[model samples]
Target: MKESDPNKKEPIGKLISYIHRTQLKRMSRSLGEYGIGGGGQYSFLKAILMSPGTTQDQLTVGLKFDKATTARSVKQLEAAGYIERRADPEDRRSHQLYPTHKAIEFQPVLQTLLDESNAKLTRDLTDEEEDQLIALLQKLNLED
Candidate 1:
């Protein structure tokens, strides 16, 4: 096989990977001041805030993250005083996660940050283009 040409168009997966890394870097920088480490920590916090008493297993599945990643994110959030874990009423072995007062207070700020991030990401796109992009991406069949 011949070496790939540099002039060739980049693969879709490569473009997606680059975009994901860029977004993560931006989000990490923005969230660091609030003691929220990146790697979807904000996502976990938001989910807990939206649906308090959700279990780690549910987060893992809902967010398409591995169990270990979910556990690690939960631990970090707990250490940062953003969330708490309580014994599940239905199952003693499982713990239900809840956002703490700090997280509740930060919810609005988080929303603003996320909105700003999204705006920045799509600054060059027209409203219709952005909607079309979202619709196209959603059609990629990302379900597990």
Candidate 2:
């Protein structure tokens, strides 16, 4: 196969991957002041905060993460005092994840950072383009 030309159109999947990596790196740096080591745990914390009493198994399936990754994030957040794990009433084998006061307090700041990143990413796109992009992304996401 011929080498791809940089000046030519790039694959959307590759572009999205680059964006994901860069965004994660930037988030990790920005969140350091708040004691959030990396941005990986942010989503888990947000999910738990949004749905209190969600179990680790639920998080694993809901977020499409492996069980080990989910468990590690839960453990880290719990150690940071950002979340608490309690025995599930229905299933003693599983534990429910819940956000602590610290996690709740950090949400607004996290949201602002996310909003800013979104605005920056879409700054070049028109309103219609932004809507189209979101629709396309949703369609792609649903394919999985």
- Candidate No. with top lDDT: 1
Give the lDDT of residue 126 in candidate 1: 100
- What do the candidate models score in CA lDDT, each in turn? 0.93, 0.84
Query: What lDDT does model 2 reach?
Result: 0.84
Candidate 2 regions exceeding 4 Å error are 1-7, 141-144
Q: Please identify model 1 stretches exceeding 4 Å from their true place.
A: 1-8
Q: How well is each residue in 49-95 modelled by candidate 2, as lDDT tens digits?
A: 89999998899899888899888888888988989988999889888
lDDT of 1 at 84: 94
Clashes of each: 0, 0
Ten residues in a row with the worst lDDT in model 1?
A: 1-10
